[model samples]
Target: MAIRTTLDKDLDRLKDLLIEMVNLSKTAVEKSVQSLAHQNIEMAEQNIEEDQKINDIEEKINNLIIQLIAQQQPVASDLRTIIAGLKISNDIERIGDLAVNIAKSVIHIGAGPLIKPIVDIPRMADMALDMLNNVIKAYIEKDIELAITTAKADDEVDALYGKIIKELLELVPSKPDSFNQISQLSFVARNLERIADHTTNMSEHIIFMVKGKNVDLNA
Candidate 1:
């Protein structure tokens, strides 16, 4: 009974850290896109610097999971919970890295005015952020249905990314002077698309935690 109590406390800590990691990643992504849209170099640099915080949280979650497994010797559902948490933390960390990528692209584009007004990239960022938020909520609530729904939203983000690429390609021939901005914007869109992909991976982890079965929500 004492061991079970201690394990429960550790698991709770893990959940708290995971949620913190998610929030930080979300903030990084939001700021990344905002910086790109407004050519805010300071905001972009801030998100890039703060990415370390997300990495720190991921490390803490990993350490806690290792402790739980080694000390508690959890089995069945408890073991599944630990494993899922481990996988989800990895996904969240990658999400943070992708957000940093977008921020870096913003910096590369510099503070110069974009040749075209930003639109679809921010829209894609919004969808990805929403999917990320809902995925974490689904994990907290242990709602597999919500997880599935969140994963499905990735499709819309992908569609938007595709459209952005098409539009950018169309402008390439006519807008020779805008080459650098166009290139960086493409990179930003790709990073946002990848963020949605990582969020979908987290949704899969949540479903595994709840069902003890490998289900592909991304499909």
Candidate 2:
């Protein structure tokens, strides 16, 4: 059945706003990494400031969601869409905070030399970003297959994170003097892993929005 209520249109607009928020968060994350990799303090600072934009968008989306619930009293799929928007917006905002945490770590580490070239962390970041991008697409299109594929992609990121942890452990033993630097790198890796996990959560929400069945991607 075709949706016949103004609530449906408002829900659609909310989804568009969410997509914009996700894109903004993605850009913030990308810039955060670039700043860390290049030791560009100014760029890192810019990322911190840009994070406010994501927060503002999230607040606006939340208010709209509340209004929909109070005014439209939508049922079934319309209700699911609003709930999904709420969940996804929270996840995206958390990702933005994680990016800011990474930037803060860069500031803490300062212009000191990296203990090693940041190959694995960057690879992990790219994977996480791709997963996030796909999640947004799947949500927008209500594509169940895309959501499943995005959930599956999380395993690749997990594997990369495992490798990073192992390599860092080895480096810790050999480069005892570089412990502090290596520790910071390890934190960055952990943050990237967390971001990927959030992306997975968003994918699961997409599945719920489309199928109405709860499936754990972590399983």
Identify the candidate with maximal TM-score.
1
Kindly list the per-residue Cα lDDT of model 1 for residues 42-92, writing each as its tens digit.
998989999999999988988898888888999998899999999999999
For candidate 1, what is the total of clashing residue pairs? 0
Q: Count the backbone clashes (under 3 Å) in each candidate.
A: 0, 0
State the C-alpha lDDT per candidate. Answer: 0.90, 0.88
Residue 157's C-alpha lDDT in candidate 2?
92
Q: How high a TM-score does candidate 2 get?
A: 0.95
- Candidate 2, superposed: residue stretches over 4 Å from native: 1-5
lDDT (Cα) of model 1: 0.90
| Model 2, span 1-219: residue lDDT tens | 343567768987898899899999899889888888899988988899899999999999999999989978888888888898899999999999999988888887789788888787878899999999888889988998998899889899999999998898899878898887777777888888889999989988888888787789889
